[model samples]
Target: MPQLTLYGYYKSSCTTRLRIALALKKIEYTTVFIDFFNKEHRGAAYAAINPNMSLPTLAADEGDGQGPVYITQSVAALEYLEEAFPDNGVHLLPNNAADRARVRSLVEVVVADLQPRQAAQTLEKLGNDFNANQDQKVKWAYDWCIKELQAYETLVTATGLAGKYSVGDTLTLADVCLVPGIQNAVERWGVDLDKDFPALAKIYENLKAVPEVQGAHWSQQPDAPKE
Candidate 1:
């Protein structure tokens, strides 16, 4: 079996999602730290691996004699892991179609809606183009985090699908997306999940207690800065 390698930064929520999923699925892989602070991701070497110059690119040998195939997008990489290695570990998506759709819907609440706005590139663009200050950029991220988390809370409550986890009490892709999203919001953007979104807070608390999730924490990553 060819070794799996993940190229990412510890602080990236997207990267953290992949970490959580990989851990939950019991997939063992190596990591290459891409130092975002040094602008390593924008260099020619990384661009060769991922033309988009994004963090969290997953590469693995297909054992077909072809070079490793790389999955650039986090969500796409997750689905690839599920389909390609179904029997290896825990399933992140539900078996049923409706439940699957519900999980995907919740995933987009964080990936599509919230993540893009709070990404470093987005904040940098705001500063460069609009002359927005640090406080303003933080405000931009904070507002979106609150709005999206509130939407997530409302969706879970209204659908009644949430029991112990995001969908049907199982640790699905939705929870994988939620934990890191909330982490970025609370740690970077200063949104209090426990105070403003109690439902999500409770779920997050439970999810964090899981050994897989705890092991995948950003602080536990090899690239994370030491305190």
Candidate 2:
């Protein structure tokens, strides 16, 4: 027993990101689920583990016989786990600071591009609508994705074919961020990669082939369907 645990929502893009990293690293963990639809994230117990009340909180082994080490935030959690137990697993930051900075820049754009849509959707779900403002926000999010994905297409083309993901032929934190952004766009926002952005189509297909990237959960499994 490695004494590691991960708290995540099966359908959350953020949760899906961390889950891929842990799986690729071959780290064993017990996954705890939080229902996003029912707002189970607001529960007291989960909030206690994550003050931000977010998904993908990883509890890694602290080398003690006691409980695992607690961590929150998918990005920070991934970085922390990598540094805490660095044994040649996938790395978010390259050894060179310049490379690391470049990687972080790409990662930031991916995250920044995704947040606007999420905010818009969350507000809509909560029934707050400024009419014109909401419409503009939605448009901005879609536009942002188009521009960012174009840039990503160029960047990946420049780098050539990576055997795994983002930066120098292995899965990195940037890759972790990339997968969820695509998932969000495709599932919630209904962006068609093949039709809207053919350049991104190849990358999306490649990512889908990766087992770690797939994880164990699917929102529309044969047994489960949206009501």
Winner by TM-score: 1
List the RMSD of every prediction in angstroms.
1.0, 3.7
Q: Tens digit of lDDT per residue, candidate 2, span 6-55?
A: 88776777777677777777777787777767778889988887888777
Clashing pairs in 1: none
Q: Residue 118 CA error for candidate 1 (Å)?
A: 0.6
Candidate 2 residue 156 Cα shift, in angstroms, is 3.9
C-alpha lDDT score of every prediction, in listed order: 0.92, 0.69
Weakest lDDT window of 10 consecutive positions for candidate 1: 1-10
Model 1 quality (TM-score): 0.97
